[model samples]
Target: MDFKTEFKPLTVQPQEIEGKSFEIITEELGEHPFTEQQYPVVQRIIHASADFELGRSLVFHKDAIEAGIKSIREGRTVVADVQMIQAGVSKERLERFGGGIKVYISDPDVMEEAKRLNTTRAIISMRKAIKEADGGIYAIGNAPTALLELIRLVKEGQARPGLIIGMPVGFVSAAESKDELRKLDIPFITNIGRKGGSTIVVSAINAISIMATALK
Candidate 1:
């Protein structure tokens, strides 16, 4: 005996499928605390991972939404902790706002410096990143060390990014790093726990970039 089910999707059009998905997401995730501006970003995050808990766990600074939008519209650089994030974001949308993604973790110079300092490439790459893009939006999804280093830079008045989207996934310091990020007055978007990844970061950035395109 063979058990097989024949099924067809509700819609074959991409736009309609996305619209149906958003409707389902909204219907299930009712009465969220996020504002009109913040909800879209949260929606994209959930859409990317299909994790309601992760979507609900999102936290935002007072200026986070507007700051992220402004950064993209102003053509500031966007920094990512890993190549996965760099690859996941919509480059065409980001570049439409004159912004571009930068990832330094694999750069030879950053690698060499990390080895010399006996540190993770994440830590050194951040040091280099701040110099190149002072007001960039940082997307850190896979490296807690990178988030910590950027937080340290913020505390020391050495770096001033427009926004930091930090949700590094791990059991070690991911939650702790997000806690530290919230303490700062700077603009940032983060989650409450270790349940984050490159997809979350990419979704957040893509949402913001899409919003920014309205101004262009």
Candidate 2:
């Protein structure tokens, strides 16, 4: 989606100013796919066409969810059981969230395994659901040039997204992508160091899910 309208000018504001509306650049929302309201203020503007009653919905894959739970019940800590989110890493809760371990995807074989094992699929599916409601997920996968090209496209009046989730894990280009994402000032949840993998992505998703529930 190309944004042709420029409201005032793109100047960063320290706080929301009353009566001052900022232009929200986002992709076209045909059929709302988001279930949970990620950003209330922005949703009102960008998702104006969407029905609030049916904002976004989440239907966790039962098998996947169960597997994650069973892993923890069996006392396995070698790998992260990121199915049920226990608590926030930054928060002291009823239970410690993860095993304090990090995973990274740097090999093609591992990436292929992640896809086959349904980890990658789960993350992609969740993201696609969000994209359906607003725009597409903006971030560098394993390609920094592609991300810059995408930004160029949006800047050059080709395409744009309402939100961008920069969740790239590990690669020779991960640092470059992270830098570009920071420069773009996109909203995202990321792990420290090279922590992009099937487990890591799911863990991040679980973390957000827990946060959403906690807010309620």
Candidate 3:
């Protein structure tokens, strides 16, 4: 039996395709609580994930958009939970503002420390990052332990990040980690449940950076 059918894309151009996709997402998503500045990040997340539910589940601090934009424009350093997120962010735009991204999960020092302490590298990486990237954006996606450690750092008053994008994906502690992030009274962008990943984090960072660039 042959179950083949013909399907064609509406547009071959990348920008057109993205534009059309955003239009559909906006039309189908309908009313939402996101503000004018925050909606673009939500829209890009749905565009990247094609999951309206995840997009709608996003919770933002009142200062999230402004804080994220300020960090980018200020050329503050960005720390990612893993290499995938570091690779996915737009380094070009970031460099234009003297900003940059760093991922320390693979660093030799973090690795050695984690092994010595019987802790995950994700946890150690955040520990290292906070010291070096104060007032920076922390983008966590893929490691629940990292997000938990960052939350701990925040509670202890050891971390003063400009914005925290904590959306690690997993069955163990992923959702719980975000719940803890919500308890803090700092600027953050997070979501409900364990439905998050590096791609969505990159989408969010890119959207915020794009907005930041427009201001320049």
Candidate 4:
């Protein structure tokens, strides 16, 4: 099918989020993207990847999950908590669950700050965050250094495995993080390309939360 990509800008509404649906926040982009024509195909791909969350700004939600599970079935979900990735060394280890592996990237703005900080402080903070996560949700954030640190961690470990989700909210850094994860041959998904905000990250998480709730 010839699917056209839309470029509608969106705003995120945090308080309005519920169950698995988010308020329509793509008004800024107009009828460019997220229209009926594009939602299905985009929904299909996300479903293939087992991503079924919705956002107040953009992305798919609960309805998308039901549609998605019908097609793709054989993957794991990883939740990269906002803090875990920011922390540095011992972030959560959902991959430790031992399955197809899915990753959820958190807020990207936070990482941008870390990236610009002093090298020593940045490393120290990251390391602390990792230790705190110990295998929890932690997005690589928008900081290239943070993503690079994650790459280093993976390379040095040689035992970690699963999908990587880098939701950086910047131009170069977000793209770079996604590239790094791709290089590792780790299946990944991200809103970095759109300069996504925290809402996008939350939307991705909401997708996984659907399955999580279902399994319960």
- Candidate 4: list runs displaced more than 4 Å: 1-117, 120-123, 158-163, 191-194
How do the candidates rank by lDDT, highest first?
3, 1, 4, 2
Which regions of candidate 3 are displaced past 4 Å?
1-10
RMSD of 1: 3.9
Q: Look at candidate 3 and give me any clashing residue pairs.
A: none
**2 against 4, candidate with superior TM-score:** 4
Q: Which candidate, 1 or 4, would have the higher lDDT against the true structure? A: 1
lDDT comparing candidate 3 with the true structure: 0.94
lDDT (10s digit) by residue, model 1, range 53-130: 999999999899999999998889999999999989999987876889999999999999999999999999999999
Query: Against the correct fold, how does model 4 do in TM-score?
Result: 0.45
The better candidate by TM-score, 1 or 3, is 3
Query: What lDDT score belongs to each candidate, Candidate 1 first?
Result: 0.93, 0.35, 0.94, 0.41
Candidate 1 lDDT score at position 157: 93
Model 4's alpha-carbon lDDT is 0.41
Per-residue lDDT of candidate 3, residues 105-207 (tens digit) = 9999999999999999999999999888878899999999999899889889999989999999989999999999999899999999999999999999999
lDDT of 2 by residue, 157-212 (tens): 55444333333445665555555555553343332233343333333334333443
